[model samples]
Target: MKQPNKEIRVLATVTDYTRFFGLPAPAHPLLTLIDLSLCRHLPRVLTPVVQQLYTVSLKRDLKGLMHYGHQSYDFSEGLLVFVGPGQVFAVSESLDTSNVSGWMLVFHPDLLLKYPLGKKIASYGFFSYELHESLHLSAKEESVLDSLLLSMKGEYEQPIDAFSQDVLISQLEVLLNYANRFYHRQFLTRRTAEHDLLSRFETLLAAYFTQDEGPSLPTVQFFADALHVSPAYLSDMLRTLTGQNTQQHIHQRLIEKAKQLLLTTNLSINETAFRLGFEYPQYFTRLFKSKTGVTPAAFRVSAN
Candidate 1:
């Protein structure tokens, strides 16, 4: 029996994406601002799609499921969701488009050409976050973003001028900066939940290290997956709380375990490396020296 193809679709260009939803072609080849309210006739997407574009979108009173990453969110309040190039998006159920409010700013990488945002945009960690971890906006926060978007839209409607790209890019940078600020605020205000996730992360770290068998080395992705957050989201949250990212925390734990083995166990340094899940002993030795100012052998010698 022939099974249907489940391969994800790719909407390679902004025009293709706009056309797929029966919208007018974009004014610029590389960028577009879409009002979600106009998308009342969106077609069902039988397969998931990956778009090679960057999008910063706001949604309000949206109905039904729009899947991004592994989690689902109820967008009853104003919220922002970002999607970078090559992220998959799926609409599992039809949206009640009549009540959908907000705009989506999408642009190709080329649109950022010769601008600082082209490079600096990579630093915006929220772009890599999952939808369920979206930024919930208060009314005041939403107003600030809306005013900025209005400026961007005014520029977008103007005919192509030498300063059009420059104006657009400037407004975009401001929008992104404000979103960054708001995300930081979100982290601080949601202290209870953030700390809970932190505690869960620590517990998972301890359990992984204390495994009697198969003590596989942990990666940031592993911890993020275990904690049900994106890798970027997990690291950002940890940094906000502890001033150290996930990798640093993992290394701290690993080093503590190394010290414990050196002091209490009869295992050779080589054996210690393997037991700690290091595939190569020299790498472990180098890491120990870097973190603790001594190689594993020297540490064991000095401690005794």
Candidate 2:
């Protein structure tokens, strides 16, 4: 008997993605803006797909979960989600494609080539955020983003010319900038949640050092996993609220622990370093000096 070959399809281009969505070919080879409302029908559910293009989508009035990063998000309101290349995502089986509204902007990485935005794109951390951490846009924010999407659509719909790519790219940059601004605004406006998360992170970090088991040094991923948030989301939230990212926070906590061991314990420098999770005493000395402007021995001498 012939066995069926089961392999997940990887959509490697905008055309491949559009074909899967039952849409016409894109106006440009490298970019496309899809208006979901125009699609008269969609699959009841979509299988998980790994795509090789960046996707930014604003979904509204959709009923079901969108899974990404081992989590699922219900798209019951105006929500913005960004999926970078090579990420796997799927629509829930209960998805109601009818009454779907909003737009999907997908672009190939090659489209960004030779542009400054290409190099700077990685700094937009929201792209790596988890599904549940999607940006819930206010009505005003939705309108602002919708207008930008429409502008991009209009620019690209015109016949391709020398100015078309540049115009579209400029609009895309503006869209990203606005998203960045709105993410910062979200962090500021959600004060109660932000404070709660910050408290939880601090408690987790403290407990990690106090615990006797596990790795000697804690990683940013440790706190991120403890908080049920993506590393990028955790770092972005901390950066927005505290002017420090996750690794910086971890280092600050580590240094605090090191200082305590150095001053309060009767351990030698090597012992102190080992207790603080450093394999190399010289590395610990280097870091301690860099952070405190004094070597561990010098610090202990001053403290004594």
Give lDDT: candidate 1, residue 165: 89
lDDT of 1: 0.86
Model 2: clashing residue pairs? none
Q: Point to the candidate with the largest TM-score.
A: 2
Deviation from truth (RMSD, Å), model 2: 3.2
* Local accuracy of candidate 1 as per-residue lDDT tens digits, 1-304: 2221357788888898788767778998889999877775666554677899898999887877666655445666778999999898766554456578899988898989799899999889999998888998889999999999988888999999889988898899999999999999999999999999999999999988997553878999999989888899999999998999999999999999999989999999989989999899999999999999989998999999
Report the C-alpha displacement of residue 136, candidate 1, in angstroms.
0.3
What C-alpha lDDT do the candidate models reach, one value each?
0.86, 0.86
Candidate 1 at residue 170, lDDT?
A: 89
Lowest summed lDDT over 10 consecutive residues: which window, candidate 1? 1-10
